[model samples]
Target chain A: MDAPAIYRIALDVMGGDNAPVALLEGARAALQAHPELFLHLVGDEDRLRPLLAHTGLKGELASRFAIVHAASVVDMDDKATSILKEKKDSSIRVAAQLVREGKADGVVSMGHTGAAMVASKMVLGTLSGVDRPCLAAILPNMQGRPTVLLDVGANIDCRPDQIAQFAIMGSIYAEGVLGIPGPRVGVLSVGEEEGKGSTTTREAAEALKDIDLNFAGNAEGRDIWNGKFDVIACDGFVGNALLKSAEALAEGLVQGMKGVFKENLLTKLAALLTLNGLKRFAARLDYAEYGGAPLLGVKGVSIIGHGRSNAKAVHSAIRAALMASEHRVNDQIQASLGRLMSQAGSQETS
Target chain B: MDAPAIYRIALDVMGGDNAPVALLEGARAALQAHPELFLHLVGDEDRLRPLLAHTGLKGELASRFAIVHAASVVDMDDKATSILKEKKDSSIRVAAQLVREGKADGVVSMGHTGAAMVASKMVLGTLSGVDRPCLAAILPNMQGRPTVLLDVGANIDCRPDQIAQFAIMGSIYAEGVLGIPGPRVGVLSVGEEEGKGSTTTREAAEALKDIDLNFAGNAEGRDIWNGKFDVIACDGFVGNALLKSAEALAEGLVQGMKGVFKENLLTKLAALLTLNGLKRFAARLDYAEYGGAPLLGVKGVSIIGHGRSNAKAVHSAIRAALMASEHRVNDQIQASLGRLMSQAGSQETS
Candidate 1:
C-alpha cells in the first residue's frame, strides 16, 4: 500500500468532558506518531498555551502545530439554533471555519453534537444535491471490517429522499475513508421480505436499487452487527433509538456481570483470573474505540465525538479526521451523488 | 405473598421447533412445580400420548393433565389471515377456543406469533375498547426488576390511539401480573422533551398525558434498561426493532466472548475460571429466562413464544400464562381503560 498523504486537522480543545487536557494530550500523541500530520488547536489561548508549554514539545515537531483562539464557546446544553445565532465566535465555529478557509483539511470536535453539526454546515456548507447531512458511525462487525450506520440522530424526520442520499454518502465514506473496495448499502426495516417495511422505507429501498452502487435489500436491526452489509441507512429517529438501545443493553449487561462477579469470594477469585480477558472482550464492543462519527455530505470532513471522550478517544477522533481528509471522502460523495442524478435522468428519458 | 390460584392453560403441543418433546417436557416441569396447576395438551392424540406415557406421569398427578386433539396445524410461514380462513381446527386455534369456552383460563403457543395472535383475537375477542392486540416483553433492567416493553411486533403502523391503549394495558399487566404497585408508564420518544420527537410520536405522547394512568414523561431508549419507567410504550416498528437490536447485541457479545476465550491456552484457562460466573450473568440477560411475550388488549390471556424455543423456554411461557390468568390481568386492563374513558367523557361535558 502507498503511504497516505499529509493532512491538516483542526482540533477543538474547549470541547468534551476532559476538554483541554485530553485534547492537548491527544494532539501531542497523534502528532508524535504521524510525522506527516499537522494540527491547528482551536480553543481559548490562555488555557491551551499553558498546557502546550507544559508539554515542552520543542524543535521541528512543535513547528508543525499551532493554536488559534476563539472568543466564545458552545455548551452541551445550549440549543442548536441559539449556538448558531449567539455564539458565532465559538470554538466549534472557528474550527469549522478553518476547514472552509482551507487552513485545515478537516475538523474534529467532542462537543455538543447538534451545535457541532450546525456550525460545520453553516461555515463549510453542504455538498450540492445534499438536502441534509447524516452522521455515520463505524461499529465493530464479525467480518473483521466495521459497518457504517448513518443518520444516527442527525435528522428526526428523514424522508425517502434523505434516506437514499444517506445510502449514497455512507457508501462513499465506507469505500474512501474506511478502505472498502465496494460497499454494500442496506436500508433499515423491520423485516427483510419484499413487502415487509413501511411505505416510506420501501420507497427508499426502491430508489436505492436505481443508483450506480451496490444496493443491498432491507435489513432488520440484528443485521447491524452481523456484518451482512457495510452501510445501513434509516430515519434519524429510529436510528438514534436503535443505536442507544444497543449501547445501553451492552453496557447494562457488562455492569450486571460486574455485580455478579462481586457476589462471593469464589466469584471474586474468578473475576481476578479472567479480568484481563473479559476487559479485552468488552473493549471490542465499546463505542469509545471509534470515539467519533463523521458528518457526511458536508463540503469538508467534520467529526463529532461523544462528550465523555477521554484522551485515547480524542486521539482516535483526530486520526479519523485526518484519514477522511487524506482519502478525499467528500469528493467521492459528490461524485457518487452526481452519477446517481445522471442515472435517474436517463431512466426517466428511456 | 399469597399463593397464586390454579389457572388451567391450554398448551399447543404441535407448535414450535422442538414440537412434542419440548411441549411435553415443559408441561411436565410446569405441572410438577405448581400443585394446583392443570393443563390441557392440545395436539394430535397419537403423538402426545406416547410422550406423556414415556415421562412416567402416572397416578393422581396424571389426572391434573388432559389431552385435546386438533386436526390441523399452522406452519411458521402461514399467513395470519390465511390461517384464520383455512385452518380453524389448527392446534393454536383449538387452544384459543378452550379459553373462549371457559375450559381453560389461558392459552400458550410457541408457534408463529401472527398465527397465535389471530387465533386468540378471533376466538377470545379483544377487550371492549381495544382496537389492536400488542405483544409485551419484560426486559431485564439494571434496577434488579425487568421493565415492560410493549408492541414488540404486533401492528406495523401504530397510531397515537394504539400507543395510549398499550400504555393502559401494559401498566395493568405490570401491576397485576408483575406485582408492581401503580407502575409508571412512559411513552417512548427520540428524546425526553415534549417536542423532541417525530410528529406521530409527539402526538402519542400528548395522548398519554390525558389518560388516568401514571404517565411518566417522554423516555429515550436508555431509559428502558435503566428501569426509570415500569412500562414503555411505542409503535410496533420502533419497539420491535429496538427490542431485537438489544437482544442481538447481547447475544452477539456473548458469542464474541466465547470466541475470544477459545483463542489459546491462557484465554482457555481464563475461560474456565470465569465460565460459571459468565453463564450466571448471561442468564440474567437471557430472553428465554422470561420466555413468552403476551398479546395484550385481548379478552383472554394469550402467551406467544419464539419458534426456536426449547423445553425450558416453553415451561417459562406456560408459567407466564398461568401468572397472567391468576392475577386477573385482563380484568385490570378492562377496569383501567374504563376509568380513562369515563374521565374523558366527564371532562368533555364539563
Candidate 2:
C-alpha cells in the first residue's frame, strides 16, 4: 500500500530552558499520538540521534521524524537583536524558515520568546499589510472556553492602527482556529463605558465598534476573564502585563492553596479531599491546554510556547500549530484586514 | 469599676454594594470579636436604624457600638467629582471629615473607589510635600506573608516622580503595617533586566537605586506574587490592571472549579474528595484576608476596600486601617518623600 501524505511540524530543538528534552518529548508525544504526523527536529543531529535511540518509540514512528542539523543555537537569555545578528544557524531561525519555504506546515518553539518572535518575523515575514506581529494566547475564562487575548508581548508601543489590526487578527484566530462562532471582540481599557480610557485606547475602541466583527464595547482587565467576551485586544505592553498578571495569580492561587493546606491538620485534611478537583482545575488554568501563543500577523503558523514548557505543553503547542494551519488562520486574518481597510476608506469618502 | 477605653472605628454606612447590611454586620462582627472595639457608625440614622433591627446582633454588641448619625448618605456609584462638589453630607465625605477633624480615630469605607479617593483627598489631603495620593494593596504570597503592591488605582497618569513616591510609600507600609523589617522594594515592569522596560520605567528604576530603602531593582509581572520582594511599585494604570487581572483570575479559577465539579459523575466524585481542601484554599486566596487598599501618600490612614465587600472583608479592612494607624505609615512616608526630593535635587546638580 502507498504511504499517506504526512503532516509535518518543525520543532526547534535548541530553545527554552529545558530545550532538547522538551522538544524531544513534544516530538515523541505527537508522533505517538498521531501516526500520520511527522516532525522535523531542527537542532544538532549528533545530540538528537542519541536521545532518539533512548526515546523508547522505535521503527516507523521514529523513522518518520528527522533532524535538520543547525550549527548554532540561540542563547535563551540573549537580546532579540543580538540573537538575530549572531545566531544565523540557530535552530529556531531554521525551523521558522522551514515553514516559510513550505517544507513544513508549522513551526513550534519553547524558546526565548523574543528570539522566537525575531526568527518568525525575519523568516516567515509579516502577513500582507500587517505592520508588526502580535502574540495571541488563549486565556481560561469563567466559561470553560478561552478568551483570545492579543498582543500578549510582541510589540510594546502600539498605535491605534496596530490595535485595530490586532482586533481583526484576534477575531479570526478565535473563530477559525479555536472553533468559536462569530467571536466577540472587545478592546481592553480602564472601563467598559464608551469613553473611559487612554487617548489611543479610546480611538481603538471607537474604531473597533465600526468593524464588521462582533465588536463588544470596551472591556476592562476584569472583563478579560469574565468570559463575557471571546477576544480581548490591547497594546502589547498592556496585554503582556494582563497576561502575566493572570498567569501569576493562577499559579499564586495554587501556591496559596498549598500554603493554606500545610498550615494545620484540619486544613491539610480538607486540602487532601480537594486535591483531585484542584488539580483538574489547575490543569484547565495551565496555558499549555491551549498550546503556545501564535505569533499573529506572521505569514505562517508560528507558535511561541513558554520557555519553561515541559513535554505536555510542547505537545499541546504542536497541536495548536496544526489546528491553526488546518483552519487557514493567516488567510482569514488577511481577509479581515482587507475588509477593515476598505471599510475605513469608504467611511472617509462618505 | 470603669470599663476599658474601646478603640473606636468610624464606619461609613453608605459605602459598599450591600451598604447598610454589610456595614452593620462588619461593625457587629468587629465589636463581637474585640469587646473593647467601638464602632462609630456614621450615616443617616433613619436609614441605618432599619437595617440594625434586621441584623439580630444589635442587642449583643449594643453597648460597644454607637451610631454617630449624619443627615445624608452618599450613593455608592456616584461620580467622584459630583460627590465632591454637592455631597458634603455624603457618608464617605462625612466619615473622612470625621477623621480629619479628629472626631474619630480612623474611617473605614467600602464605597465607590473614586468617591473614596476623592473624599480622602478632599478631607484628609495628601501628606505635606507629597504631590499625589496612591493606593496600595497586600498580595498574599505562598509563605503566609503579604507583598505590598502599590498604586492599586488612585492615579492613572503617573509620571516617573509619582512612581518613586509610590515605591517609598509602599516600602514604609510594608515595613510598618505588614511588619516586614527593611522591606525590599521592586518596580514592576515587563522584564527584570536593567533597562528592559519603557522610558519612564527605566528612569524610575535608576532613581530608585539611589534611595535609602531596600531597592531590589525592576521586577516583572510574574515576580509580583513570587514573594522574593516585599513591595512592588508601578504606575497606577499598570497597578490597577495587574490588581484587577489577579482578582479576575482568582475568581475565574474558583468558577472553573465549580463548573468542573458540576459537570459529570466522575468529576463530582473528584469534587467530593476535594471539598474541604478547596474551601480552605479558596479562603486563603480570598482578597478579604488583607482587608483594603490603602490610599498611600495621604496625610491620614485611608483604605479603599472593594465595593462588593462582605462583612468579613469590611471587618478586616477596619483592622487594616488600625494597623496603618499604629504603624504611623503616613509619618514615615513624609520622611521618605523628603529624602526623595533631596536625591532629585542632587541628581539635577550632578
lDDT, model 1, position A326: 77
Query: TM-score (0 to 1) for chain A, all models?
Result: 0.93, 0.92
Deviation from native of the Cα of residue B3 in model 2, angstroms: 18
Q: What docking class should model 1 receive?
A: medium
TM-score, chain B, model 2, is 0.90
lDDT tens per residue, model 1, A157-245: 87887899998888888887778878989998888886677777898998988768798899888888888989999888888888778
| Cα lDDT tens digits for candidate 1, B1-350 | 99756689999989899897888888888888877789999999877777786764556679889999998789877787656778888999999999999999889999877889888887889887687889998887877677999988888777887888898888888887777888999888878877888877788788788767788878888988998999999888888888777777777877876776676776677567666777777676666767788899887889998888888888888888888887888887878777777777888899
State residue B59's C-alpha deviation in candidate 1, in Å.
Answer: 2.5
Candidate 2, residues B97-140: lDDT per residue as tens digits? 87888776677889878888888888887788698898888887
Tell me each candidate's TM-score: 0.92, 0.87
In the order shown, the candidates' DockQ scores are 0.50, 0.35
Best model number under DockQ: 1
For model 2, what is the C-alpha lDDT against the true structure? Answer: 0.80
